[model samples]
Target: MQHDQPRPRRANKSGIRQVLFNSLSFLLIFLPIVLSGFLICRRYGNVQWVFIWLFICSAVFYGAWEPRYIFLLISSILFNYFVAIQLARSKSKPLLAFGIVVNLGSLAYFKYLNFILQTWSSVLGADFQPVAITLPLGISFITFIQIAFLVDVFRNSSDDLGFPKYALFVAYFPHLIAGPIIHHKEVMSQFTNARLAAISANDVVGGIALILCGLFKKVIIADTMASYSTPAFHLAGQLQPISFFDAWGALLAFTFQIYFDFSGYSDIAIGLSRLFGVRLPVNFDSPYKATSIIDFWRRWHITLSRFLRDYLYVPLGGNRHGVLRRYSNLMIVMLLGGLWHGASWMFVIWGGLHGTYLIINHAFHFLKRKIGEQSLSVLIASRLFSLLVFPAVMLSWVFFRSESWQGAKTMLRGMLGYNGILLPERYQAVLGSLNDWVMSTLHMHTGDLVTFGSFRAVLWMILVTAFVFLLPNSQQLLSEFDRSSGLAEDGHLRSRMLAFRPTAISAVVAAGVGIVVLAAIYAGVPSEFIYFQF
Candidate 1:
């Protein structure tokens, strides 16, 4: 979803400007100019000038997509800034409420109006053609950031650093489109004169390391996975049958595809922000490795989870209430969190499914505590993670990725083996009657997900699985270099040998990786990250 433009660019067929982190134009043209301009501004004037320059550059980056929406963005910033200062001065709850309403109102107008229309049409049994409402890119993220700032100000948590700095925080291109959903507390302190003017060698090296690694993830691995996954999903959408092997293969491929895609985007964001000596909150943390739904939420999209906890859950009375209320609150948060990603019932269902998983996970913990020993936590964690959680997560992804409920149902049925297993034609000769039974009873089809052979799909799964489970993440690799790798104290690196060392050999290895990434962008087709639509 971060596949957007920088500066003024010729419009694509969709009328969206054609530049993104994946584009060579961004890599070769835009980033260099912004970085140079930032340094020049920092050198020539005060920190305000630095922020102003960055703010303007950020506007250009965003406006490159649709120049009209830049006005909406600025209007939102100015309105929020004015109200935040007023709320801080007056301590008026009404002022804060008004600010939040207007912001949410803007979001609903652009993002949810079409959704509302369709829902009404269905409910009323009246055909209503949806209105054309072009969503402002990153409206969801922008609204959240501004609302957080306003509330934080009202709470007297973070200082109002004036408009210029605040605008830069909102418009900062790296995390602007898709985000870690940064807190005012996480970034505002780094806006000071001393921090912006200075640069660290480690930041440079680590940042470059992160950006290159992210590029590889997006352009090569994620895109490759997409090729295996998309057609299968499309088949399901078309109401066609999929074999168990094909469905599972496609599901697993998508699981890796989204992970790598978002992980790539997050790394690029953190790394790019790091280049400016500004640290963003960590977004992804090898979520597929998480042992429980609770643990998965803790690891994946961390800042968004934190935001939900702090802003929504706490306000709704959190776990302080009785068990029933706590469970209720959990469902509400998860459902809204799902809707927050996109205005779709599919996302809502995905969120609800996760909510149920969390409730079950929590109930297991509660019941176990009453009946058994605390010592079983780690052992149960491993058992549950492998046997239950991972498979459940993969299952939920069907709804998450599918365009229609029918598609999701088809995929789910396939995974459960109702749609049957795909066996190779060679098995017909080996098994005779059994092969006949396999052909008819198992519903082996010629045009199923893995029609050619299961070999390629199976191999892809192995390679991606190894990359996911074996290797240290970009954050871990850069932890030694960039202090804001956000690796928790308890977190462990898979291998110290994988650590980034500032040596000649490491540089050479990095160069090799970079060249591979460059080759990938040139040779491979460009794809937008999944979250970009949200």
Candidate 2:
């Protein structure tokens, strides 16, 4: 894994304007220029020109970071496209294998070669000089996407083939950097549609609304959570002992932080695609509300989950053999899933924990079936069990967030109260006689106990948790929302008063929210999407 940087780190490359979907440069300047040019191309009845221009624009968007890396992306796209066509004509297994190898080989060299060399050096007790390797942006995501397409070709599922469409699919700016992992099947059909060339007004309004909502999620909610989580996790990474309350505080903060961060990015990607009269797959669906680990995987990073299930899990005798085999397959998929996030032992452990949780969840599900109908107590117990799963998930997240295993261990120890559960000295007197009595009854001695964290941090944790549980998610808020019809009847407003549909009043509200978010972003540095690292 890469070294953990200090908190509030500048996430973007040094540049005038990058292709961040949320940035003002992207929203105000870049998008308009590209859209106008593309629409004008369409207006002139030049469909082929439209595709060519789009590929150029998308390449420019991606290359804005580092022009050198654009060659890597283009090479991957061309090699895969050429090899896929060969696999189609010759139906050669070795050819398909070669293609997969080249794709993964490039990914390993760029992303994991140093990691491997460092590990081997430690094992061999010798210094293995590592070569300088700078990871190209979105290598992991783009590689996985191409691999999926190649696998589909080998299986004779991808019958359609075109270089222009394929190039655009690979470099499409919306999902390029971070993605919902668009499938060859999902996007290729859309690209061939002639209607997409012409811009629609409804698409414009709906797209902007989605973009603003995503901005709200990132700037207003996720960045705020980062303030609390970063320090706590940083302390853990330093191997410092934290109090029980502080540990939970940090874990909870991250649980929400990652949710909003990546999901916020997903929202923006989907919104940007909509702006171009295309649709990307939904990646998140209020995963925190899920009742089981199995359910949580279904909702969280839905695209990745789909890819793993279809490509890895099913191919490995998924549930077809026996219960034991099914459990093993789950472990394999999740272990690789964690490792896919980064080259770290902690990620492997995190995946292992979730795999165990899934096994237990499935076991309980079996028992519930055997037990049949129960009384109110059993139902309440089941509900509590579901709620308890969140904390267990949070436990796994310590490994996920920490810089190393040692850091994870430090945080876990604090969470288990190896560090004292101490109230602030200032608040000790406020607890008065009851504090002393409780401490004595519990066979605990209270000295000048250190406080876990600031009252404000705790307060933010409470407020964030409340919002997670109480409010509807972005998907639910915009469900069945039609641009032409204003708002669908099924798109009922449950929690908030502001309408999701574009209107004179709703536009004003969205504009106000956008202004506030833009102000917050300009006031501080723009944060990078967390998933970009993967």
Candidate 3:
């Protein structure tokens, strides 16, 4: 019933500011000004002056999109700050509850109201007029950060860092828009007298290297992968059936694209924070290498996982109550997590798929506990299980990538070979030459197996696969060189090779990579960070 459809083009908006971290403008102009200002303030004025200037600069950066929205951001911060103050002083449950409602209400009003209206209209077959609403950039991220702050206030777990420091925490610009979703305790404590006055050589070197590495990931790897994945997913939206090979190729391409894109954003955010002499938490750690869904969550968008686990999963009674409660909690957390990403049914389905995967994973673990295995055997089994887990992860991405249920269904059907398969026309003659007997015995003609338009996609797959399974991640690469910062140093074999050092060769390599990234940004079309939508 479906035919090929044209894919909707993505709007090329980079961020709230015209300057993207991946863009040359941020590198050549905006960053230098901000960094210089910070340094100058540190030298010439008081710490309060530095904070005030940083806040002003951050406001300009955010307001670059629409000056009016900056007021929303400011209002949200002040309102939440006041509530937190009241909550801290009175320990009133009512105030905490009101604060939670206001934050969520603001988010829902901006992000979901239109979607809700559309859904209701369709369900009731009623004509409904929906009002235009532009979602405020980074509302989802900041709201969650403030909510965490409020909860900490309620628990009496956070220090009373005054309004100036707290405002800086919320609108720091680096982790403000897209985030590793910083914590109050870690970030607030670091904004001390000593940290404000200093910018170390290690931080500068390490930070620049991270920024270049991140830019390479975004401009080179993620963007290249997007070209392939976009059209393939577009085929689904057009209701066009794809071949088995095309479906998998596209799915795999997007898998890498999103990983590299968002992880790249996290890397840049952390690196920029470091340039300011503050360290944000590491977010990604080669999540695709994970063997289980549980392991995958721990490694991918790690701070989001931490937030969901600490805020939602734990509050839902966690594993303490019963097996049923625990499973239900996992489902709830993942479903909300999916909804948190976007206002769409497909996202919900994507979340549901992961929830199911987690349940099955836990069931398998329970069975294994009952039938205990040797350590060596378990390790081997886990490796094999990881192979199985990856394809399942890819399958869930079908929903994530598709715009609608029908689109997802079309892609899934193609992946299962429900749609007839054919090799590319270029390969027909060579495949036709295969011995008839060999073809008959195998029940597959050469024509039946498709070639992805070119071998380029396959090559990309191989390269990214090697990187995921073989190469050390950015965090691991920088681990040895910078001991002062809390970068992750998980003892994986591949991770041990590239210990960052302030050597001539290291400087040359970093410079070369930086030059290449800058050239690419100028040469290639500017694209938005994938997570900016979320």
RMSD of each: 4.2, 3.5, 3.3
Per-residue lDDT of 167 in model 1: 85
| Better model by lDDT: candidate 2 vs candidate 3 | 3
Candidate 2 regions off by >4 Å?
1-9, 15-17, 128-130, 197-199, 371-381, 425-455, 483-499, 526-528
Greater TM-score among 1 and 2 belongs to: 1
User: What TM-score would you give candidate 2 relative to the actual structure?
Assistant: 0.90
Candidate 3 has a TM-score of: 0.92
Tens digit of per-residue lDDT, candidate 2, span 1-534: 333211223455544236566677777788899888877876774656667888899888877777888898888888999999888788888887898899889978877786678778778877767677766777788999998898898888874777888888888888887788988777657664466655577677767777888888877788777776777677877878877766777777778888888878888888788777887888887788888788899888899999999989998999999999999999999998987887667777888998999888887777777776385655776788789877888788888888877888888898888976656655566678787886666444444322234666667767878877777766656654552322223333563453366568887888899899888777765474567646
Model 1, range 253-340, lDDT digits (tens) per residue? 8899989989998998888987887888889999988877899999999989998999999999999988889999999999999888
On the 0 to 100 scale, the lDDT of residue 185 in model 1 is 67
Model 1 misplaced stretches (Cα beyond 4 Å)? 1-19, 374-382, 425-454, 489-494, 524-526
Q: Can you write out model 3's per-residue Cα lDDT over 495-532, one digit (the tens) per residue?
A: 66566778899889988988888787777564646676
Clashes of 1: 3
Query: Which candidate leads the pack in lDDT?
Result: 1
Q: lDDT of each model, Cα atoms only?
A: 0.79, 0.76, 0.78
Q: What lDDT is reached at residue 491 by model 3? A: 77
Looking at model 1, the pairs that clash are 1-529, 1-532, 4-19
